[model samples]
Target: MQKPLTDFPTGSVVRIAGIDGGRQARSRMLAMGMTPGCPVTVLAGGPTGCRVRVRGSEVVLCCGLAGKIMAVADDSDEGPRCNCCPGPRARAI
Candidate 1:
């Protein structure tokens, strides 16, 4: 099942299921490559915001902004893996 991006734990590898927001917000995220089906790893988060690695790049988003992005948790033991990078960087969420 899909849940708000914030619902997932840090280091979880999740696939973007969908997004919720107005045109501008959605466009911004999409343009930044946070589109549906993309795999993102939650790096760190707090009450207000979090940092995520998207498409091998790290990006930060506020809780409100993150709430708009929905994701399906992946079953892989390791966290998100950036194909562009090397080494076993994945961690348990």
Candidate 2:
């Protein structure tokens, strides 16, 4: 179920499961609010990088950084609510 963040498509809602990189990468992501269990919505992506919304803030990550982020589909009943997400079943992916 876990996959690199870059594997997800636009509008997909997923949760951060872990980081695949070293301490520095993890620390940087953490400071950006990309911690385990944090919800992320893929706003847009390509081979180079992607944009995501985390806890209401938008953050851009290069492919290398995004590849270091392990994520899984968010299947909770409540999911993570946001103006963009709207509801549990509103995900575009």
Candidate 3:
């Protein structure tokens, strides 16, 4: 059920499965705290780019970069879920 980040609608919560790109792309994303298995929420999107919340920060990514991020919908009903980068946290914008 993996889909590109750009493919997910705004307000969707998904878990990053993998990144499809070169080493540089992977490294940049990792440094931005977008590691595999981490939860990400789509904040807003348009034709050029989109904003997403991950690792306690909101990031704006262009379509190219966002398209490289593969994530799966987090539809699990399990309570209090946590993962590699810790579950979503609340932070003031």
- The best candidate by lDDT is 2
Question: Over the stretch 14-75, how does candidate 3's per-residue lDDT look in tens digits?
Answer: 87778999999999999998887677889996557779998779999999999998887766
Candidate 1 wrong stretches, greater than 4 Å? 76-93
lDDT by residue (1-93, candidate 2, tens digit) is 788899999988888778999999999999998877677899997668889998778899999999999888887533233344455444433
| lDDT by residue (tens digit), candidate 1, 22-63 | 998899899888776567789986557779988778899998
Candidate 2 vs candidate 3, lDDT winner: 2
TM-score of 1: 0.76
Worst 10 residues of 1 by lDDT: 84-93
Give the Cα error of residue 21 in candidate 3, in Å. Answer: 0.2
Worst 10-residue lDDT window for candidate 3 reads 84-93
lDDT for residue 32 in candidate 2, whole number 0-100: 93
How much is 69 displaced in model 1, in angstroms?
0.3
Compute the lDDT of residue 15 as modeled in candidate 1.
70
User: Which residue pairs of candidate 2 clash?
Assistant: none
Q: In model 3, which regions exceed 4 Å deviation?
A: 76-82, 85-93
Q: What is the C-alpha lDDT of each candidate?
A: 0.73, 0.80, 0.77
